[model samples]
Target: MTTLPIYQLDAFTSHLFAGNPAAVVPLEQWLPDETMQLIALENNLSETAFFVPVENGDADFHIRWFTPTVEVPLCGHATLASAFTIFNQLGFAGDEIRLQSKSGILTARRDGEAIVLNFPVQPIVPGTASDAILAALSQEKPQEVFKVVSRDTDYVLVYESDKTVRDMKPDMSALGALADRGVIVTAPSDSDDCDMVSRYFLPALGINEDPVTGYMHCVVAPYWAGKTGKASLIGYQASARGGFIECTVEGERVHLKGRAVLYMKGEIYLP
Candidate 1:
């Protein structure tokens, strides 16, 4: 028998049941890949994160993320949740937590009430989505479309207004067919406090809608920063359980700042 400590946190929000909820499981050593995937399936959240201590000088821990159905290369909100657990629950005695991941070295640090994540900027290039994809996405036509240059090859659709992004009702069946690709719809924000608004969908990954995505902003913040000529901007993910992120673009990196609240703490038993 094996027992592990687990925590559930609402990332990118100040309150519970608001942001994207992720499960974090702390481990002394790496578990089998199949076991981790099964654990994520049991959690049934957008993502479940697992970490093991590392003696490597480069990083404090090695982290991995998993969706309900499959393991993912990188996940933003879950990373924040893991960092929150480490800083607040595990009593980690460091100002910064360096996590080695499949996406490379990811770092997190405290900033008052927020945990700031320093992630690599996912660059975008002009690309096109199939008419079928666009049609299934929304009724209105997008101003432009671009492909994110990353491992997931996500497509970004630029709308004329925040309302357009908000009103979209994507066909999950059609999108779930494209298991390798995710979609991001975004537009300039109507509110003065927020610079942009967006939504994320990846049915193939078993997430029809991610409530608050920190990784999506890695692409969105830079795109908006270039268009609005502002390096620092705020983004609002307008999901049912909405949340906000403060993004600051600097060269090839972006700093994502958001708050996380612990929702549950318990133990998991495995045999």
Candidate 2:
């Protein structure tokens, strides 16, 4: 039997169990896609990361990420978790780790005790949305709904109040039918703990709601930063199980600041 090491870490939070939990597996070679998917499903977290040594640099590596159900182009929390696993758990001596990923090359670095991730900034432009998406949410649409394609996200619906965003119960099937990717509903946060609050739903993508998502900020960070005219902001993910992220817009890149803690470390036995 061959055993592979697996490490679990919470990303976007300093302490264990506070932020999103992701499993990290450091592999010597790439496994078959089916095997990788099986590992992700068995881990049963939103995402699991697998990394192999990269060609050009000892301080660098190549990484891939998989959700339980599918492989996404980009994942934030998992990348952070993977970096933490590489540095603290694997005992790599480094201030930063750069990895090539499906989303393109990405970097995660140590900022004091916290890890700051630099990812591409994808913002929304104003456009019109089909009624399928509009009809899914129970709340009233923002007056600004008739706008741009917003890249892959549907709309940046700004609500009148936090109550409406918090209390909203989307018609999932309807939302799924309406969206090709999904919708992100945001509100100006009234919480003193955070600069903004929002929720993510991707009925079309198979996830109803994610606990703490770093990838969503690829769009959210830039959109809100432009609105506030601040390059740096803090975001709160408003699910019942809440998570927080510190966001900064750097030219064409977005910097997400947060802390990670290790949860579990073990192995996967493969025949």
Candidate 3:
């Protein structure tokens, strides 16, 4: 029998039962891809993160992220969860943790009560939504649409008001049929505390709605910063379990800062 330590954390929130919950599995070495996928499926969370320590001078660890149905190239919330585990549980003495991933080297640093993630800004270009996408979002028309310029497909839909984003009910079946793309809906915040509000839907990734997405903000923060002419902004993801992120856009990277809370710790038994 083999046993592995596992942790579940609510990323982007300081309290339990909020934010995006991700499972973190610390590995001594690489596990089979199938095994990791199965483990993520067993966890049944939006994402499961696995990391192995590396001696490479570039990074302290190598990490991979998986959804229940498939492996993803990058995952923001899970990466934050991994950093939290390393700092709080693993007794790492450093204030910064650098993780090498498919996306590139991601750095997480301790900032008072929050963990700040340095992630590459995903550039966006004007895009037109497909007819199916338009039909799925029939309740509210998007004022503008832009596509993230990356191999991983994502579309950003701009709405006129935060309420439209909060109350939107897209046709999941229709969106799922267009499996190649993830939809992000956003609007200027109605509340003064936040500059913008958003909701993420990726049915094809087996996540109908992500509670609080750090990855989505990589695309969102820059777009809003250009619109609002502010380098620093606060964003609220108005999902059922809401969460907030402080975003700062630098030259080519964006800093995402949020709080995380440990929810569970246990062992995963395997044969």
- Report the lDDT tens digits of candidate 1 across residue range 1-271: 8899999999999999899999999999999999999999999999999999998679999999999998877889999999999999999998899999998999999999889999999988888888888888888999999988874368899999999898888899988785366899999999897999999998878889999998899999999999999999999999989899999999999999998999999999999
Q: Which candidate is the best by lDDT?
A: 1
lDDT of 3: 0.92
**Which residue runs does candidate 1 get wrong by more than 4 Å?**
none
- Going through the candidates in the order shown, the clash numbers are 0, 4, 0
**Candidate 2 clash pair list:** 126-147, 126-148, 127-147, 127-148
Candidate 3 structure quality by residue, lDDT tens digits, 155-190: 899999899998888788889888475899999998
lDDT of each structure? 0.93, 0.80, 0.92
lDDT of 2 by residue, 197-257 (tens): 7777877656777778888777777777887898988898877667889998989899998
Candidate 1 clashes: the total is 0
lDDT of 1: 0.93
Model 3 lDDT, residue 121, Cα: 91
Clashing pairs in 3: none
List the candidates' TM-scores in order.
0.97, 0.90, 0.97
